[model samples]
Target: MSILYYGLSNSSIDNCTDVDEKVKHHYLPVCYGTIFIIGVVGNITALLVYLVKVRPWKSSTIIMVNLVVTDLLFMICLPFLTYYYSQYDSWMLGIIMCRFTRFIFHFNLYGSILFLTCLAIFRYVAVVHPMHANSIKQKRWGTLACILCWAVAVAEISPIFNQIEMKLQDNKTYCFDLASNNPEFMWPYSWVLTVVGYLVPLVVVCLCYWRIMKELKKGPHKESKKRVRARRLIVLILTCFIVCFLPFHVLRALRIYTRLTPETNCMLDRWAHAAYIISRPIAAVNVILNLLLYTLSGDCFKQAFVEMFRCDRLVSKTKDIVKVAVISKPTTKITHDQSS
Candidate 1:
């Protein structure tokens, strides 16, 4: 999704040949590989905790579960990209897979942003308006919101998937790595992501958090544990936006401008590509960072993990003690029975 428009026009390809593909190929595998391991483990554990440990799921739990689903969906797609970059521009899967990967990528990226925004709003309502919290905090409401988010994301990425083309370059097949052959379709689609998909959710998240923080400062629950956790979550959410989403959207806009404008040259193209390469991995870092956020929010998640392992260890030890008693007490038990 970040590099949906990575290719050069035929004319620009001829004139601007200074970009190095090696840097992207070399760095992307390492970056994506790390994300894959950390994100899979972190998100899977989160899902399990939410599903198995957290009972009678509430709005926040539902929202977090959806967030984990979004992260895992994106994480699952990373290996294919890792393999692609490892192949150094070779795409073996053909056009269908090319489009499929891009669709999933955009869907998860936007889905996460939307879900986070929903969480911010939900929490804000729950905290600022406790009287109305029941209305907003309903599990059914959260489920409906999540369904709407998925529907919107699917609709947004549909156009991009339809426009994806596989290009042959120097005997290697590149999947969705080429600029759209149609500019009319590309610019509008890009705007939808940049404006509606990115900017609107960003503003919504910020606004909700700001209001929530303000309300907490003066509200009766100011010193409550729930309030404190809410504050920490707000901070973490904003941190993710500033560090993860901001750079990618900025560079994505710049990339779009550089690719579309008449004045675009090899120099600007190189700069755009370089900046984008750096920012993209940072955006993907959110999946792993969410794990840290989960741990930092409160002791509940840590406690859950401890309890899960502790129960297993206790069961194993009890079985061992039972085995030892059985091994050592058989003859004594028979003698006692004869005396009785």
Candidate 2:
């Protein structure tokens, strides 16, 4: 999900004035409420699988953990938003919670993108340069990458707090996303985020996956299993990119350009605004899809899930105990025979 879309959903003062109130009063709440339920379940499941079942020090686990954290953080903020929209634009939560909520949304939006980029780069190195993957795939480097991603996401999105505020209008309070208030800053910021934060990373993911597929095709027949797995991961990445982020950037670009136009009328504004409201939820649900994607991408996720839920270890211990009992019984019988 693009932060710009999320900002637009919250900050569009024009929306309260122009778009159909029923969208906010009735339908929007349902969408966000559903998101809240599913996002919480999926993100929590992913978090536990990584934290408990998977080894923390592995490079892949590092990226997966951060991605899950980002999603979980966003899920945590959904209740506040769900309540706000449920009230039909009333915001009794004050400015700080408003800003904090919006800030967390952006943090999740960008943090997910950055961490995914790291995963793509890591996979590229692992597949394309197997021998050298060992050096850069160290836990320390993964930790450093995660820290850098968080720091950069924070720096990029912190200015948003200045643009957002609570508004009292028409007997209702509104948590307004003021991103459009300063068109100059927002326009450039949107472009930078769309390109550098999202587009560039998306391109990198595609390129790496494409290269990986090409290499897989060239390998020997015994590597066919690996090739098939690589293709699945590539498909998963591309599907996620297309479904979650593409519409957001396209609509965002249209929204920005429409705002810049001198002839921007009510009809165009209404369409763009409503489209964003509907599409934002779709993007938000990507966090849930990400958990699914993680499961499909590797056997490690499946094994972790089994470890988290199944009694495999307990069964193994029981078998060991039974073996010990059998051995002792044979030894005692031999001793009794000798004594006799």
lDDT of each: 0.75, 0.73
How do the residues 175-243 of candidate 2 rate in per-residue lDDT, one tens digit apiece?
754333446566887788788778888999989888877767774783666566677777876776788
Where model 2 places Cα greater than 4 Å from the true spot, the runs are: 1-20, 178-180, 222-225, 297-299, 311-340
Q: Give per-residue CA lDDT, model 1, range 1-340, as digits (tens).
A: 2233434342435555434365678888899899999889889888887666765677766777888898998986789988998887689987888888777777777888888888888877877788988888678988998998888888877886678778776788877532333555666667778789888988998888888888889937588877787778888888888888888878766766677775566667767766777777788887877786666544366567667657668878999999999987987888899999
* Index of the highest-TM-score prediction: 1
- The C-alpha TM-scores of every prediction are 0.82, 0.81
